[model samples]
Target chain A: MIDLLEHYAVAIMAILLGVVLAMFLVLIFFAILNRLWHNRGISRKREASESIQPLIYSYLDGSINRSDFAARLKNKHDITATWESIEIMIDNLSGEERKKLQMLLDLPPIKKHFLRKLNSRKPISLAQACVYFSKKTLTDKSIAVRLSVLQEHSYNVIAYAATLALVNTTNQGFRDMALLRFLLRKNNASMAVSDIIFKYYDISDDKEVAAEKLEFFVMNPDIPDKTRAAVIRMFPELGFYQTADTLRDLLQINVKNDPTGELTAALLGVLIDFSDQKLREIVEKHRLWESPSREVRLKVPGVYADIYGEETTRILLGLAHDPELEVRMAAQRQLLKHRPLISESRFEPDISTEWRAMKKSGDADVSNG
Target chain B: MSQKVLIIDDDPAVSNFIKYRLSKKSYQVKHVDNGIEGLDAIRDFEPDLVILDMMMPGVDGREVAEQVREHGLIDPNRIIVLSGKKMTDEIKALFDIGIHDYIQKPFSIDLLLLRIERALASLKSR
Candidate 1:
């Protein structure tokens, strides 16, 4: 029985060693293959850069006409190189040069090449095609339809790229549908979302229509608070001060109910940019300076300073004694930054002492530096 | 003698395009891919006008411009910045260092040629 067990153990050990040796040899083979493929790619890129780039430059400079340039791009290699050159030129050149390049995209071979890429099963290839289409002005209904179908792709990146491509189209319905699909996606309230919306807003010919669409998103309670806050922040940046009253109303309703303070802070932050006497009255009525959320209170001093200017000294003096260090520091900084419209005689003795101490520390830091 | 212009942009597409265009206009043009070579070319090539790109991998256009001004290798006004950045405080500060002009990227080749002509003309006048 002992001899039989030893023989079985030795046989197992031999098989394991053979398997390991096979794997090692396979890895070496792959490494060599990979290096050869890498070298080939590098050489091809070099050849393209050297040979095709000059022909493109010539065509652009009008030394050689379009047909002559097209005739030179005979093989798959030449076409690929020309495509690469076109991508670089399109990105870095604009005005008349960009128009010339855009005309190049309409060429049958180039258009067909990219259209085939759009139908590719590879996610990267499909995404690249979507981005390329996004850059060009599209009149093809079939391309838009393909993009719309790709918008539902299982891969998030491909779907997002497809959505962006659809948004670039001139069709309002397509743009609205794509944006809605994007915004309604679960947990999609991100900076990228804000950027896409901003781009959509920027491209809209009718500013009013775009603003109304944004306001719809802001007012919709179904939208997540973070997403709403992002949309609200866009208003002031985009010069949509017309939404000031609506934002103030939202703040009034949500301030007491807001647990995270994000919505309140966003509303306060934007309203500060549109600061006025009416805003001050609303802020004072809401008692936002004493709000439980430190983030909301932090914006209060700036709001007060903008509306009250030097007269903010009194309020800032009161705030400088607040429980939160950040709030106190914010109020103190405001006091030092602007001279009071009110005279020094009006300051309470303790408040005056606190102001003097803050000023001394600020000066000491500056001089020390 | 043709006036010499040195291009210090990292993008070969941009630099090559400018070189081809400028060579057509009979200006002696040379391009370097980074700031260190740019500074060396500024000294050795001694081009009359330098077309500097603002953003680069190491020692950016601003630093190169600052070094040039600091070393007094060339007149700060002989440098024109080609940037993709909008008119911000930083770009404004570049002008404070006395670069000749700032052209935003995605610029028309024609506009660039025009600006190059004007910059060279201004340098000649001075």
Candidate 2:
């Protein structure tokens, strides 16, 4: 037993010694690696700035065009550091100087540099490329290729950056418009594009032009699905001049394509949020569940209680027996959510005999459709 | 006797660009990179117009503009505040202080130059 105790202590000490040794090696290795990285970063930055300063100063003096200034990158040391310094300058200026910097980004050499980095298999490289594309609101076909690759990449940051780059580069400063159309219509990929618009883009620009452009793009079918839905979700934030008639027209147009109830609910919610007398009357009289999309049919019950009194509760009551389980469940959920709002004195449409007559008159067909 | 325009901004690039541009228009421009120094320049340069920035590390543009106006160091109407940090209330407050005009940063130099001429002209009329 004493011999076993001695052996166990030896075993414990061996394990402890191994852990301590491993930790010491790891600490030393990382310390050396960090110092090397730091030194290399400093020297690389120095080299990049040293090579570019003369050209930049000359450009400032109006002695050189942007193409000639950007062309100097061909002889660069540490392209990353060089790009970083140029990016800082771009961010620092505004008006014509900033516009000139943006033009430089589109120069063939710089574009080639970015395009090459955009195709790199690593996620960080892709992210950086996306960021550069966003800076000038650049729209390029080659960058689109990188976006496609990034769409399938496993990294979340790269995926997000790629989408924003696509939106920024292609959306033509109508991110609010594009995001709303695609965001609500497709009901996916909303958060990333929304974040980019709210975070990066200046919202204080000309609202009239933005509104007109937003209206045009939202009405453009060729735009991607997610982008259109994003635009739909972005309506309130766009702060455009909205009439109930426009919302009504928008609903009529949007309902045609809605494959699910989500769009109907969203459009109706928009109608409720931006309430209008004519729109409310239209909602009160119209059979909302007449939408072909089951998703739209499911949304009718949820929105019905807001438009009319308990007499119109028959609409939901009729929908309770919908053939699609999804629609019936949706009705049940709406009934519970809106139970408090139900009027104690039901409307003419709520009478038992009137309900029965309505039930027999193809009301189910309206919900099913 | 070129009209003196004192530019108060922390960004050297912006201030230098404005100074070089305004010099071509025959406005003698003096630039200081922060608010405290700007206050001193407002008193010393006796500028016909002062281009101020809203934000800085110490002695912000608002405070400097307020002090310049309140203490009678410069005509409040000769002060033109430039800021990217825009707020309607802040702009109204500057206007209430009788500052000359406001320009958002990243502004057009031509527009800024024109505004300065108008501001200085208004001062001359006064």
Candidate 3:
């Protein structure tokens, strides 16, 4: 019985030893796989560096143009790898090697490409992109980068980028609606389409072309009312002088007719752009100053005052004593622009208290009117 | 002689109305929906006059008018174009293509009758 028990114990010991050896083998296999994976990753990175190595060498040897370097770099494959490799090469270059690179960059294409990359890639910020693109010193890459930035997600960045693109286009001696449409569709951002339109009136050198494009915008009902109003304001740039009547028609028919407060203000801005003395009299005669819609009275009327100064001043003075606090406040604010040497203390009314009183009076005035 | 007229228009309502009014006025008329059929009907019927609608689903009225003028079977002077939309720069191209007269859409039936009468009377005089 003791001998049988000893044989069974020996068999169990052998089985346990075999299990331990299998476990050790599996661990070793896994460790080898993990090491192979790590080495593969390192090799891939090295291969990428080697692929970009000649471009870096060419840059250091002064054999390639800057523009050519930039165009190749801009191609988007292994950019980070190539950039890092180039940096290492630049650092390792001796004084003579560095001077060769400097001389190579002086080549036209080299200078153009390097400057373009500097403008396009140097600053990551949208605002920086806009400013860099707007600079006269920038190469064409600046304009190209600016266009991409105009389609940026940030509103302010888009606005700045759009403005830079527009100014650049204008500097290139072309005026067209294509740029406007491009920016609007891509950015979905507008500080004021109308504001840009208004600026075109004075800035566009060709009257016929400016008129033709402006007419197309006004006729196209697809554009928003604010943009249409801005386009109407630019009619004066068409040099027809007959645009005043067309503007008046648009203001009366397109804006005031719809009863949209924002559009009314936009039309009023168009009227201000007209700057005709006769229209000022019409405002005075109609007693538009007393209208209850603060938009019409305050907003629209203020724009009128800005253009027809003395008459607007008289109209605003009457509103300064208006029963509606909003009307009074708006009138006061409009008056402030015309007031010279005016301090903040000269016109700081108790806004909180006045706001309540104005609300009460505004309701009362609406009922009475 | 029954002075036959063919109306080529995409809108059924317009074609029917014109056909009904002209037939009531005692003129024989045939109507077709598209420009191709309108041209074929003109060739078959040899109508004294053809009233063509400018905008159509296929082979627009302007192209039909050009084809008719090209065939020389129908006199260019006898064709009148009726368009529902406003006159645009494209109308100049129509004029160059031999469309004699154009009447904008939502036109009064009375105005159309007058135009037809004037055109027929001028043809008689010629």
Candidate 4:
């Protein structure tokens, strides 16, 4: 019995030792693979960037002909890394240079490669593909498949990126609405989409689609009030003076809907860029200083400050003694800034001298505005 | 001789794009990356036109303009302003000193070229 037990113990111990050795070997093999895989990715990206930079610069320098450039792009493999390199290269460019660079993406094989990767299981691939699309203009038909997934995609960031790409791709009114429709669904990211639309007014990578298209959306009583308000609020910052009259109309409608008048106030702030006169006219139209919303009332001083005249000064002075302390202080500040030392200074040569001196000698630190 | 143009911008991409576009029209374009280098290039290149970018680190675009005006290196008519942002009230002052045109950044190369042609033509028309 003792001899049998000793043999059994030896067998069990050997089995245990063998299992430990096997695990150790497996772990080491994987560690080597992980390192090698990581190194390969890094090397591939580095090689891709190194290879693509020269062709881009050469093209930008007018050295390489377009046909040769297109041919070179077609022959280059590993387009995922190639897309990344192209994205970084063209991120800051616009105009003819940007268009030329973006044209490389229109090449058949590469566009097919990226479009195919839109369904990629890898999140990184999906995100990168969307970014390239974001920068490159896409035909409506090209983006229709991507648009379907935008509303249903489980991945919010990828969806947002894709939505931006769709918006960037086309300026057609129906297409924009389609993009907006997918964006506005009762998804968790609706508010986020609203913020994105407000902030990135021109990421369209193209010029405005006609102010009327946006104006029509804002005018449609069927759309959500918040969306219309955001649209009007964005008009001033968009540098689309074409929408100035549209904004004035929207401002009237917004104040009527939300007595708090926050949207009206915000639009009035940027409307100064289009017309100080128009801004003043809107303010006088609404009698905004008397509006119940303190935010709207506070905007009055800034608008008043924009128009220089005794009438504007008198209006500001009236507010300087108004009931709301914040409104009073803002008005006082505007009045102080425009105070003329000489009665005739508005037309005086000395006043002109001062204005010129101030305009010429900017804040010492700034290079551009 | 090719028409001489100097482009002073902090962004190499922009400068190179301008250079490439203008070179096609046979303008001899030289680019400098910053304010100091821009100042030096103006004197050295004696360009027929200077495309000045606003928003450089030190010796900023305005400062470069001021120094150029002070030195009489090139007339204000020879200068065309480019800005990454809106030309603020202060930067607009450069217009009075002879900035022939203002082209906002991210502008179309077509627009920049058009403005360049206009600026040069203004000099010719005078």
Q: State each candidate's chain A TM-score.
A: 0.78, 0.48, 0.41, 0.66
Quality of candidate 1's docking, in CAPRI categories? Answer: medium
What C-alpha lDDT values do all the predictions have? 0.82, 0.67, 0.60, 0.69
Better of 3 and 4 by lDDT: 4
* Comparison by DockQ, 2 against 3, better one: 2
Better of 1 and 3 by DockQ: 1
TM-score (C-alpha) between model 1 and the true structure = 0.83
A129-216 in candidate 4: lDDT tens per residue?
7766777776756465665565356787777677667666555553475555643543434455554564245554445654455666
Cα error, candidate 3, residue A196 (Å): 5.0
* Candidate 3 local lDDT, A69-164, one digit each (tens): 656644333454454443333322334544444344344543344345534533344444344333322335445544544544356455544455
Clashes of 2: 20
> In candidate 2, which residue ranges exceed 4 Å CA deviation?
A1-61, A71-99, A120-125, A137-139, A148-161, A168-239, A246-369, B1-16, B19-48, B55-64, B67-73, B84-87, B117-126
Rank all candidate structures by their DockQ, best first, as comma-separated numbers.
1, 4, 2, 3
Instruction: Note each model's CA RMSD in angstroms.
Output: 4.0, 13.0, 32.4, 8.8
Residue A148, candidate 2: C-alpha displacement in angstroms = 4.1
> Which portions of model 1 miss their true places by more than 4 Å?
A1-27, A74-85, A149-160, A186-191, A231-238, A241-250, A253-258, A274-277, A292-295, A309-311, A318-330, A340-353, A364-369
lDDT of 2: 0.67
Worst 10 residues of 2 chain B by lDDT: B11-20
lDDT per residue for candidate 2 within A333-362, as digits (tens), equals: 555455566653464544444334544443
Interface RMSD of every predicted model, in angstroms: 1.2, 3.6, 38.3, 3.7
lDDT of 3 by residue, B21-125 (tens): 688679999999998898889889988888988888879987887888788868877888888665577678788876668888656656787899788888878
